[model samples]
Target chain A: MSSCKFINTPALLLDLEIVQRNARLMLDRCQKLGVQLRPHMKTHKTLECADIMTGGSRRCIVVSTLAEASFYADRGYDDILYAYPLPFDKVERCAQLSERLSLFHVLLDNSLALQQLKKRPLSHGKIWHTAGVELTGIYAHCGNTYGCKGEEQIKAVAQQTTAITLQFMEKLKAIGIQGPKSSIGSTPSCSHPVPEMAMLSEVHPGNYVFYDVQQSLIGSCKLEDVAVRVLTRVIGHYPHRNQLLVDCGWTALSLDGGGRLPTGYAIIEGHPELKLTSMTQEHGRVEPISGELDFSQFPLGSVLTFIPHHACATAAMHPVYYVHSKGKIVDTWKPTRGW
Target chain B: MSSCKFINTPALLLDLEIVQRNARLMLDRCQKLGVQLRPHMKTHKTLECADIMTGGSRRCIVVSTLAEASFYADRGYDDILYAYPLPFDKVERCAQLSERLSLFHVLLDNSLALQQLKKRPLSHGKIWHTAGVELTGIYAHCGNTYGCKGEEQIKAVAQQTTAITLQFMEKLKAIGIQGPKSSIGSTPSCSHPVPEMAMLSEVHPGNYVFYDVQQSLIGSCKLEDVAVRVLTRVIGHYPHRNQLLVDCGWTALSLDGGGRLPTGYAIIEGHPELKLTSMTQEHGRVEPISGELDFSQFPLGSVLTFIPHHACATAAMHPVYYVHSKGKIVDTWKPTRGW
Candidate 1:
């Protein structure tokens, strides 16, 4: 049983408690809003986190890729929604999964995509469409909410998205169509749902389970709610350059944020003055945001925790998550990769 | 026997012929220069590429991570040099490899790192240090050459780096030290080596095996020499935004080069007018650089090949590389991941 301190450098450290709390809160939020929470698994595609997000039932999930859908399905988890617009090359795989899973659903996308789905109808009584098209639901990702700065802006975006979604549903009702579910998602909007969101059938928001600095900046979570950190070890001290080289790089921390943060790509957990200025494949250049870097503070082999800017992007870089609680590594979770 | 056309989208497709040509050229260049070519394995960490790179010698390679060192060591590869500065946390693992392999080298780094290596003395007649230190070789990565634009600039930087390395080697000799080797490496510098580079003992260039748009811009190789491309499919067309959505995203292509190229993040192979403007986790937004994006020209599900901006960064995002020749998939190579 290795502890967090003893783990290798450039490892993703998942706080088990923060993850569970984040998971529980989302479940509670959707429960209170009288809507189903079909958590998205794109952020951390590990079975353990999926179980946490789904509250162990492993039911009602959304995946970004068929690889994740198959990974979950192979493990007996069902009721999945392939959330993206239908990809034609993957239609056959989608059909196979649809026939295998209890409720494997894909988006009712453009007419061309509809043809791909119709070419391979479900044989196991899992009917998602009929008469060349089927209206399961309308899905809209409130991705603009990611630009929000605070809770008020987030709620405003959520309210707008929900109202428009409801108006669209009303239009569908006018055309003799009804009972189709509506889903609007983005971690920011879902984390601070508007009151009108209760009218939707389900809410799907990933990244909340592993809230990060981006979610914090978007007002989706407090800084403390971030559950994951890239644990890196200082390898060199360059006093002349006023920089420190750490073991984490784009391969471990990702270049998603574009190093735009005030603290650079990620926020140093305890060092406010330090910024992760840039990275190569396996080396990160850390320097102070203001004054000269005190090289003694970051001795060689000293660990520094990084709260990632985007959890999904950083999580994808790591092959395994070191899940820990109270500084003790409790478990290791492997994630499925590739589509 | 799947072909490139039938394989799944958002895959790394390696051109076997190009790769072989690249390996052969690098080997020939080093042989002509009278220097050992210890190709770095960070670009594509697959054994197949390693075999092609070393000409099946299975020895004298450089890796950025211990996982890579162990991965190669387990497969009977020897003379492994963990090219990174000695990381404190990985010292124990390094020691084990040091005692196990014929030549497992770590950087003779700062005094603190020297102490870490001193803590674990090598046994069984293997020696890296005695009396608190040993000088195996001097290694310098001429990474500054990555910014060079053409052959002249690359040769200039290569000459400068070689001169500085030789000067340092002379300083070591002045201090009564002899029989120490020197190495300076970068794809651009090694691709167009200066005459003085022949004085160095070794050159380790990795990304030359998978040249990319960045390397082409740096003038290391012709764009046609790039051996890998990310195969993506257009999944959606938003004619309103004049954009096409491809299944390739940051997850497949990586957020490297920061969309700095005229073609945004990457150069769409044979589609010079297009730019990969942006990407989410699983979606890439492609739009024309100047004119309207005639949607009919790119039907839904049509494939687009993308030459990555940075091959090492993009390759790190993928789990497997699909090797092909003349449009037929010949083999698949799985690369080791994690630190």
Candidate 2:
């Protein structure tokens, strides 16, 4: 902290070491399993994290928004997949990206979207192959993995998703479609990858880059592996209400988990006794889980770090992430926002 | 829509006429009440909306964040009140602002905050005059008005808050403090203001510029007064699941109001029968509140307008708001985000 300048409260802090470790482990796991790791950029949309997650390849990334795709493509990254279903209004933008980039992909779950794509033809010798729709990949998000409890349940869901996806791919092959990739995603599934998943073409998981309390609870990562935190300071101590009001609120941490966590909205880092009971626009009310809150232990000016319930949701609330390592602020990463 | 170019989907659309009407009504109300309407910028942190709310006067405004204070201050706005309890981390910044601006106010609810403020002496001769902590005004938020169900409840809460605030001000005068000023705010209380509120020096009510479903439900304003909406397009039709996927998600509209509305997270404009049931990263699952959803009626690629649950929360999610009037694109307003 001595090396770092004055940091504004309610700031998003990213631990570089934890992030790098998370990224390296995921990349190594994917490489050993013989599956392409096209990491999703929805969680930490910053380029620094993307570079670490991609192992500096800067290719084969999945983005939830066109803004991210354009942002990455503008900075020498290619082979971007706008993983969302084809937004009809953005068809022209998609066509432009497909023409400009070496391999930009758009997805369609129905024939109407295919027709919408067909309405606009791509130049540069690109054609809508495979029955007027390029069967680039079959993407399935195993979102149900979020409901899992432990390693056994996570593995079970992962295996089930893999089996179902493989069966779908077999059906595609039976219909004489070949060479299209098959990818299934969700941080919980990818973190504890099943042996059967190795047969799939790729796996996309974004939240592992900055795992939060939600993922830790779902067996995706340990609590220590979660890299990001909202650094807030106590602003008020109300003994009558048995609460300590903090500067961090939904504006900083977001309301993603619906305050369902045992620790409420988020886990107060290193203080398992504290629970973030509720938040307004710019103020979070924190109270103890069981016993009385000793106000002296948490002086008004003292800082409290909160590990968020969902990293992706929390990260979206921040404009810039302060990267720190060895108790020193190293860098700042600005994430591209909006569609 | 014909006058505009291909507008982006999942876009925040601000009805310019409605905004102007809302602003004018609030301004007239405050003028008639004989109190200064110092609008809070937390709802729409944009220069355009600020100007409209202030009747083109950038002076006399309240903000929820320091970033907003700096943003407005940089653009020649004066008489700013950072209406948050002084955080220890921001004392120096507050001092600097006080020195730079003609009038910059910071609040304190505790003695420690006053000590922190005293430490940061402003370069300008701005003194901490009143017993070591300046009583700029007695500011209280009638947040309880949010729980009200109709105008009767709204007015009752407003009157009670006004009575309490006036009593506090009377106590201050009795203690020999003469000219500090008094103010209480919140959209609900300020909208249906009590006559006693006229005795106050100023009133700060934001969110009227773009009232949302929550405020309407709270009887602050009618649903027709909501001037902002998220413009999304139906992308997928899942008859088997009885759902239609829209391109808007929590990333666009935010997960506020806890999806407690009968229409779920947001009200589908002109389609009260439809409900925005749930959302993922980049998709919203739309299902009817009851009965089978007619698939053909909402064909893929058709645009859908969603009146948000909370305008402040939804407006914060957008990078830029598309302002429209008379079915034509009039202007765009980019809001300042993050603290």
Candidate 3:
């Protein structure tokens, strides 16, 4: 059986034990808060993890792309929410998908989208009716939460998102639409305990599954709680420059950084003194935080794992993940990517 | 016949005519400089585009990952170079592939990798012999050239990279290996008319096939020469915040910005006043340069195209490309992705 040492470098590695623990933590937190957990599958876009996150019941999940919605919908996952604002170009596919699935929801924050949806021709060549296309909810993402400075700023953004969502719900109600749930959330706001909107039926938080350096800096999860990492090999050492090059680059880890984190790109798992300073398409330049790096410790071919700045963007780079449990390869999961 | 309006949103659209023109320009430039053009396939990893770039010869190509090497080799593209430094764990696979292909090369920059390659055991249970594994060339990326300010700095980086590659070639010769080509290049140095290293056998310039906003900012290519773009739709308009949200986000475009470009994220095609200031997973927040946006001009559901900051990272996000010629999709090409 393939194990950590046998797997290729620059592969996505997941600690299944840690992932399960994270899932349980988030699940229990939502249960305690008396809100339904509709975990976002955009981070780990695989059915196996989605099944575990929803406790083996593929009831509710959020997707970032229409390709994901179609992938899950094909596999008997009916309660799927395309969390991004609805694209008018995909109205036909959305309507057809809505007809097949029990609940295929599309989120929109503008009135023009509502008018377009209202005017779309159904299969019978008439204007859209409530019975023709079923929407599970109308949700708004408070993406600005990522820019929040602290608890006060996060709470303010959350309240603002909640108010906007309620206003959209009222707009829906005025247009003879009823009973659709209202949802609003982001990783920071969902992780915080205060300012929970009671009117919202569900929360869709994707990054809590594998909190990265960015989330940790935002106080959402600790560094050690990060479950996913890119397994790379040190290929070259430039001791004169106090730098080393790794096999992981922007193609493996992603170019999502310069956040509140001290490290520019990613954090070296157990080496605070080391920093991934820069990257090319296929080579990452790592350097010592201070004077010089001892190249002998990390000889060429030695493995070094990195905790990425943004888990969602980093995870999207890999096609398959090497799932491990207690330092052994347990399984391999392939995520459905692309639109 | 599929046109721009009929295709799905967040789709990768490639203008075949533009791509061909870009390819011909680079190829002709390399020929005039008396240097071989080994186009790097990392940007557009499809055999179709590779054929066009190589003039249907499939002779020499640079790949960032083993996956690309294998994909091209399987399709009979024998002269493949794994441009990234060899990963320790993938050494065995590389050796096996070397035996099967006409020419498969691995790059190295440090002595440790050379020692590892020297010590690897062959199929006969003996130390690796030159006959056991064949190398195409020794290559060094003047990746630091991207940080260079102008012609002098770029030329300096080019000279440094050429020196390092020649030094590595000398080391290879000292170990009783001889007659392997030495190469060095990056887009900046390759695009510049000066600093042409006559000693280098070839140059691998990948991003030149589809120049990006970053490349244009670097003065590698004109803005109009950019061949790839992401087709998206305006999804929301927050007139109060002077913000407009597009369906294209970091997932579709990429977070590869903060270059010398005036716009931080991307350049919206035909809209100079707008800047894509921020992005979520599947939502890009666009805003005007100064005043509030005229919401009527960019109504929700209207389409807006964006030329990404980095073409390679942006292309990697899409699985397939809609190849358009004269406003119609003439073909579709799927890129092989994964490591």
The residue pairs that clash in candidate 2, if any, are none
**Clash statistics: count for each candidate:** 0, 0, 0
Candidate 1 local lDDT, residue B97? 93
Candidate 3 stretches greater than 4 Å from native: A121-138, A148-180, A195-199, B121-138, B148-178, B193-196
lDDT of 3 by residue, A132-245 (tens): 245556666787888876667777888888888888788988998888777677877887745457668888888888788777777777778899899888888777778898
- Candidate 2 per-residue lDDT, tens place, B1-339, comes to 554336888899988999999999999999999999999999989999999999998899999998999999999899999988888888777888888888888888888888887777777577643234667787888999989999999999989988998898789789898788888878998889889899999999998999999999999999999999898889899999999999899999999988889999999999999989899878999999999989999888888899999999999898999999988988999999988
User: Estimated TM-score per prediction?
Assistant: 0.98, 0.98, 0.90
Docking model 1 quality class:
high
User: Relative to the unseen true structure, what is the C-alpha lDDT of residue B181 in candidate 1, on a scale of 0 to 100?
Assistant: 82
In candidate 1, the residue pairs with backbone N, CA or C atoms under 3 Å apart (3 or more residues apart, or in different chains) clash, namely none
Evaluate candidate 3 and give its CAPRI docking class based on DockQ: medium
Candidate 2 interface RMSD, angstroms, 1 decimal: 1.0
Instruction: Identify the CAPRI category of the predicted complex in candidate 2.
Output: high
CA lDDT of each candidate?
0.90, 0.89, 0.79
What ranking emerges by DockQ with the best candidate at the front? 1, 2, 3
- lDDT (tens digit, per residue) of candidate 2 on A41-80: 9998889989999999999999999899999999999989
- Chain B TM-score (each prediction, in order): 0.97, 0.97, 0.89
